[model samples]
Target: MTKSRIRAAKPDTQPHFDYFYDKPGSLPGTLNIGVDAQPPVIVLIDYNEADATRQTLATPEECLPYLDTESVSWVDVQGLGSEDILQRLGQVFNLHPLVLEDIVNVPQRPKVEDDYEDHLVMIARMVIPKESGGFHSEQVSFILGKHYLLTVQEEPEHDCFEQVRQRIRYNKGSVRKLGADYLAYTLIDSIIDGFFPVLEAYGEQMEDLEDEVITKPTRQTLNKIYRVRRELLNLRRAIWPQRDAIAMLIRDDNDSLISDRVQVYLRDCYDHAVQILDMVETYRELTSGLMDVYLSAVSNKMNEIMKLLTVVSSIFIPLTFIAGVYGMNFNTEKSPWNMPELNWYWGYPLCLAAMAATAAGLIYFFWRRGWFENFSDVQDRTSRKRG
Candidate 1:
C-alpha cells in the first residue's frame, strides 16, 4: 500500500557466477578469447641509462630491432582482438606455443613458470573497480627475457600500469638503470597496489551494510550482504595464487632470470598480496556475520508483529462471546430465566456498558504489564534512526 512496504516486498535478483574454462578432453594449449574482446594495440618503450624512448609500433616486427639492442625493451600488447596478430606477435618474440596459448586465453590462474631456458612466464589477474560498482578482472601475462619484457593484456580499456610507465618514461627512482627483471617487479608491485583501492571500496560498502543490517534490515540488505561476500570471495581467489607466484619467483632460483636485487622488491610485493588477502578474508567473515544479523532482525520484527496481533485477539475474545450469546434465538416468553433482562428498557444500555468496561479493564491490564509500551514507541524510534 505504501512505498516502503512495496520496496520491502520486492524480491532480489539472483547474482551471476561465471568463470573461464576449456571444454573437457580439449587440447592442453587452447586459446579461447571472448567475442567482445577488444582489438590489440602495441606500444614499445625502450630505455637505457642515458635515454628513454616510447612509441606506438605498427607491427610486432618493429619491436625486434629494439629487443636485440642493449637497451631494455618493454613491448606492451593490449587486447586480444585478432588471433592472427597474437600468433604473429608470439612468433616475433619467440614465445613457446604453450606460453602463447596462455597469453591469448582470456582467463588463467595466476602462476609463474621458469621451465623455459631463455624466458620466464608469469600470469597474474588485475582487478579495477567499475564506475558503477563492483570490479572488473583481467588476466595479464608476462614474458621476461634477457633484453626485453613482453606484457599482454586481455583488454585495452583499463589497466593500472600507467604509473609504472610514467616512472620509466621519466627515468625516476633508478628504473632506467635497473634490468628488465626489476621492471617486471615494478609492474607487479603496481598491480598489487591496485588491489588497495578496490578493497577500500568494499570496506566502505560493508560498513554501510553493517549499519543497515543492525538498524533497518530488509530483503535488500540480505542481498547486499551476500553480494559483498561473493565479491570478496572472488578477490580472495585472485590474490591467493598471485601471492604464491611471487613467493615462487623469490624462492626458486633455478632459472636465475630474476636478479637478487629484484627479488627483494618482489618480497615486498608478496607482503602486499598477503595483506590484501587478509583484508578480503576479514571482510568476508564480517559479511557472514551481517547475514546472521539480518536474519535475527527479521525474526524479531515478525515476533513483534505477532505479539501485537495476539494481544488484539485476546482483548476481543470475551466481547465476541458476549455478543454471540445475546444473539441466540432464546424464547424469552417461555422461561423467566431465559430473558427477563431482554424485556427491560435498560438491558441494551447495560449490556453495552458491560462490554465497554470489560474491554477497558483488559486494556488497562495489558498497559500496566508494559505490553502496549513495547509496540509503538520502540518501532517508531527504530524507523527514525534508520531514516
Candidate 2:
C-alpha cells in the first residue's frame, strides 16, 4: 500500500463543527481538497447469505452493477487525494454536494445526518496506536443507503478494519447474512473499539508518569505531562462528540436507512463510545493532577536546599567572628592588655581548636533537632527506589 504525507490545507485549524476556514460568502458545498493527498484505492465487498466476494475496483463506475443487486454492496474508498475519482464516486453514488464536501474536507467533527432522505450519512474518527508511542487519527465518512454502504477514509495507511474484512471474507459469522446497516454497525463498532488500545497505551504512560513525577521530576517530566494532557484532550475532542453521534444513531427513529436490528447492535456501540469517553476524561484529570504534584515536589525540593544552606551559614557565623577578632592588628608588646595569648607558644593551636570546637557544637545542635535527618532519609529512599 502507498502512503501520503498529507499537509494541512489551512494554516489555522477548525476548532469545532460550527467553525471552519473557507472563502467568505463563498459557495456552501465547495470542496477543500488537500494538494498532497494520495490517489484513491477503492475496494468492493458484495455478500449474500450463501457466499461473499471481495475485489479491488479500478474505477468508481465498476461497482455500479452491485449497487442495486440483491446482495449487500460495501464500497470502501481509501484516500481523498484524487479530485476526479472522488467527484466521480460522488456522482455514481448520487451523493449530495454538501455530503461530498464533508467527505473530502478532511477533519469534520463526528456527526450523524439523515437529511438526504435516501442516505444516512455519518462522520467518525478512527485512531490507531503507534508502535513507538502516541497515536495516529483520521476521518472516516460513511454513506449508508438502501442496498449499499459506502465508506471514505482520509488515508490508506491508518486503518483498523482488517478484522471486519477477515470476518466477512472467511464467513466466520453472520455478517454475510446481514444487510448493509449491520455492515455499517460492524465498522462503527470497530472504530469505537479501536480507541481502547490507544487508551491503554496512554494508561501505561500515565502509570509511568506517576512514578517519575513523584520520585525524579525534572523539566522533562513536566513536558511529558503536558504532552500527554494535550493528546488526551485530542482524544476527548475526538471521542466526546462520537458518543453523541452514536446516541443519535441509536435513537434516530426517523432515519429509515438504519434497521431495527442494526439499532440494537448500535446500542452496544453507543455504550463503548461512552466507556471510551470516560477513559479519556479520566486520563485528562490524572495528567492535570500530575502537573500540580510536580509543582509541589519541585517547591519542596527547593525548600530543602534552602534549609541546608541556612544550617551551613549558622555554623560559620561564630567561626568567622573568632577569625575576625584575631586578625585585627594588635600591638601586644606595647600594651599588656592587647591579647597576651599571642605571645604563648600554643596560641596558634589553641585558636584552631576553638574554631573547630565551635563548628562541631553547632552541627551537633542542628543534628539533634532533626534538621539533617531528612536529607539523609531522602537520599536513602531515592537509592532504595532506584535499586
Candidate 3:
C-alpha cells in the first residue's frame, strides 16, 4: 500500500518552465517548445447576445472558423511548451511575431502593449489555489484581438478561471453581450480576487505572531516573525508591479481592443489591485515595527534580569561584609576593649539586632527609592495573563 501511494503521489520537484526561445539575437517567431507537452487541447467558447456555442477544438486550425465570426471567442490554451502546436496556433490566430514571443515568454513582467495591430497583448499574473490550500503564482499571457481573447496559462492544474468558464457555460452574467475584452476583464478580476483569502490568512498569521512576540518571545518567535516579514516582502513585490499594470489598463488610451464600458470594469479591477497593494504595504510596515517591538521586549527582559541581579548584590554585598568583619577573631584577652564586648551578656543579641536593623534599613531605603516597585512591575507584567 505504501508503495502504491508513493507511486500515485504528486511529484514535489518543480520542472523548469522555460520560455520558448531562440539563440541570442535570433529572429522572432522561432518556436522552441518542449517535447514533453501533451498535444495542445484548445477549448473554444464563442458567444454573442443572441446565441452561444462551446466546443473542444481538435486543433489550432479549428479555431479559425470561430475567430472571424461575429461572436466573442475565448480560446484558452493550458500549456505552451509544445512547439509545433504553438506555431500552428500562432498562425491560425494570425498573431504578430512579437506577440507570439511575448506569449511564450514563461514569466514576462505583467504589462500591456499595443503594436498598432488589431490587438493588445497583456501579460498578467494569476495566483491559484495550491493543493495545500496555499497559493502559487503563474504568468498568463493574453492576446486580446478585435473579437477574441487567446489566453495562455503557464500551468494546467492550478487556475481560478473555472468560475469564468462556468459563467460562459451557464450564461450567468452579461458575458454573452460583451466583447472579448470584457471576458478578459472578468478572468483578470477573478484572479485578483483570488489573492484576498490568501492575504487574509497571512493577516491572521501576523496577528498571532504579534501576540507571541509580546507575551513570551523566543528565538523561534524571532525566526517566525522574520519569516512572515520576508513573505510579506515577497507579496509586496508581486502586487506592486501588478497595481501599475492594472492602472494602465484602466487609464491608458488603448483604442484597439478594450472598450469604454470595459475600461470601467477594468477600473474596478484596478481598485482591487490597489487595495491589495495597500494591504501589502501596511503589512510590511507592521511587520517591520513588530521586529522593533520584539527586539525591545527582549532587551527589556534582559534589563529586568540585570536589575534584579544588581539589587540582590547591592543589598547583600555590604551585609556579607559586615558579617565577615564581625566574624574576625581579635586578641580579646590581651586588649580590654575587645574582651569587654565579648563578656557582655547581650553582645550576641546586640550583634544580631544590629544585623537585622541594617538589613531592614537597606530594604526600606530600596522601597523608598521605588527600586522594589520597578522590580515588582517587571514581575507583574511578565507574569500577568493577557487575554
Candidate 4:
C-alpha cells in the first residue's frame, strides 16, 4: 500500500469552538459585533414573474421600497461591519430587536424561530474548505417575511449562495416565479449541498490515514489522526443542529411561513443534511479505529526489535561463557587437571574453534525456528510490494 503522510497541525492552531455571547444580566437584545468583523455590504435582488432587477444599494433604506412590493425581494447583507448600519437595517425591515441581535451576534446554534407573526428567523452554519486543508465555519441568518427574504452573513468573502443568485439572475429554475419562501428554501438548500465537497475532502483524508496507520505509523500519524477526529467532531456539532432545524422547517409549519412546495424541497435539503452527518460519523469511527491501529503497529514494531535482540544475545551466551572459563586463573602449575589443557599446544586454537562452533550452532538453531527468517524476509517483501 502507498504510504500517506499528513503534516501535523499544532494544538494551538486548531480551530476554536468559542462562541459569542452577551454579558450576563445584559439587555435582552444587545448587539455585540466582533471587532474584526468586516463592514456590511448590502445588495438587493428584486424579481417577479415578468422581470428581475439586481442592484447594489448604498443604504438599507433603498431596500424598503422593494420589500413592500408584490415581487420577491432578496436583501443580502454580507458582513457585520458597523452596528449603526445593522441597527438601521433592523429598522428598515421592521425586524424584532431580538432578531437583529441574533443576526449581529454570530456563531449562534442553527435554529428556526417564529417569535414574530409576520416573520420567521432561521440561523444556519456554512462551512467553507480552506485551500491548505480543514474548513472554516460561518453563520448565515435568514429573515423570511411576506414578500421579502433577508440574509445576513457573518463575512462577505465566502458563501454558497452564488449558484442560487445565478439561478435567480438567469431565471434558470422555477426560482424567479416563486415567492420569498421558495427563495429562502433555495438558499438553505445551497448551504446544505455545500457540505458535500467538504465532507468528500475529509473522506479522502481518512482513507489516506487508514493506510498510513496500519503500514508505517509514526508520531505524526498519531497527531494527524487526532486532528481529523477533532475536525469531524466540529463538523458533527455544526450539522446535527442544522439537520434538526431543517426538519423543524418541514414538520412545523403552523404559521404557514413555508409553502407546501418549499416544504417538499426542504425535505430534500434535510436528507442531504442527514447524509452529511452520516458520512461525518462514519469517518469519525474510522479515525478512532485508526488510532487503535497506530498503537498496535508501534507495539508490534517494538516486539520485532526485541525479538531480534534476544536472538543475538542467545547466540553470544555460550561463546562468552567459554571465553570466561579459559581466562580464569586455575593455578595450572599445581593442579594436574587444569594443567593438562593449559599445556596442550592446540588448546588456544581449540578453544577459539569451540566458541565459533557454539555461536554457529545457535545461529542455525534460531534460523531453523524461523526467528531470522521473519526479519530478513519482512523487509524484502515490503520493498517488493512498494516496487
On residues 37-97, what C-alpha lDDT tens digit does candidate 3 reach at each position? 4455678888888777778887888888777778999998888767677888888877777
Which scores better on lDDT, 2 or 3?
2
Put the candidates in lDDT order, highest first: 2, 4, 1, 3
lDDT of each: 0.84, 0.86, 0.76, 0.85
lDDT of 1 by residue, 209-284 (tens): 9899988998889878877887788788889999999998997573377888888888899999999999999998
- In model 2, state the lDDT of residue 340: 87
RMSD of each: 8.6, 6.9, 8.2, 7.9
How close to the true structure is residue 121 of candidate 3, measured as C-alpha lDDT? 76
Residue 87's lDDT in candidate 1: 84
Model 1 poorest ten-residue lDDT run:
1-10
lDDT of 4 at 340: 81
Model 1 C-alpha RMSD vs. true structure (Å) is: 8.6
- lDDT against true structure, model 1: 0.84
Off by over 4 Å in 3: 1-40, 129-134, 311-387
Record all residue pairs in model 3 with backbone atoms less than 3 Å apart, i.e. clashing: none
Model 4: lDDT of residue 220 = 98
State every prediction's TM-score relative to the real structure. Answer: 0.82, 0.81, 0.74, 0.82
Clashes of 3: 0
Pairs that collide in candidate 4 are 39-81
